[model samples]
Target: MSIHTFQLHDLEIGTLHDLLLDAVSDTKWKIKELRQTFDQTDQAALLEKLSSIEFNKARLETYTELLEQIDSSWCPDE
Candidate 1:
């Protein structure tokens, strides 16, 4: 989860695809939470929201790289 280094070659293609789907789900959920929080929040809430947004951004970046790696090696089912 360092957003850079990994040996994904050990994983099954289907499993890797599931991970991709999970990333999609996570980002979607975080985006919704951030949207709601920003619409109405106090200073304290704003700080927490910023932290959450940072985590979401990192996760999004990780998955983006994962996506590119997967895309590079993708193939049709045999």
Candidate 2:
């Protein structure tokens, strides 16, 4: 699968949040499947991937909130 890259300034908060949520959800589903199959190595890899995804999702949420705050503070009322 090809990964897409985005500039932080270019992404809207909602879009970034949605993308991260989707990634976490997908990782969780794969982890569940690996667990059912009783594949120790695959299960370990999936668990690691799930952990990383969750960490990244938290970071993205923090950044998104900060960006929204900055935008609200700096932008004028229309």
Candidate 3:
């Protein structure tokens, strides 16, 4: 199968393992960022808001990368 075929298959499948992996990856990523923020002496009171903002930022990055990948290979109405 081609890479495009594989990507299409991946997008179609919504397995429990994928959901769990994404959640685990996001949590681990957030914790690492928070640790870095603490090491840099960021304000404590803003951490709650920072976490929310960071979560959105991380997801946006993931989405942008996915779009970029599709842009490189995807052909509309093919």
Candidate 4:
């Protein structure tokens, strides 16, 4: 039998939201690590580069909202 690939639309909203949240969480954790490394390193140029990099706060808020919406949609009726 041949293997098949499916699109993201085939997944439930909850699954997609979970995946995005996990990715965002991982990225944030990595950023923290980078910050720590920058703090420990003595290279001024590297520290300046790290300080100049900007994070997309709006995108983060959007992902958080999406995760919240998915959780609310999946919650069982009380």
CA lDDT of each candidate?
0.68, 0.64, 0.56, 0.56
Q: What residue runs in model 2 are displaced by over 4 Å at the alpha carbon?
A: 39-78
Best by lDDT: 1
Question: Could you tell me every candidate's TM-score relative to the true structure?
Answer: 0.57, 0.49, 0.42, 0.44
lDDT of 4 by residue, 3-63 (tens): 1233534656766567567657755765776677777885875564444333333445555
Clashing pairs in 4: none
How many residue-pair clashes does candidate 4 contain? 0
Candidate 3 Cα errors over 4 Å, as ranges: 1-8, 12-45, 76-78
Q: Any idea how many clashes model 2 has? A: 0
Query: Which stretches of model 4 miss by more than 4 angstroms?
Result: 1-6, 42-78
Q: Quick one: best TM-score, which candidate?
A: 1
- Whose lDDT is higher: candidate 1's or candidate 3's? 1
Worst 10 residues of 2 by lDDT: 1-10
Reference-based lDDT, residue 28, model 4: 79
TM-score-based ranking, best first?
A: 1, 2, 4, 3
**TM value for model 4:** 0.44
- In candidate 2, what are the lDDT values of residues 1-78, reduced to their tens digit? 334556656777687668767766776775576566555566766677666657656655665565666577666769
* Steric clash count of candidate 1: 0
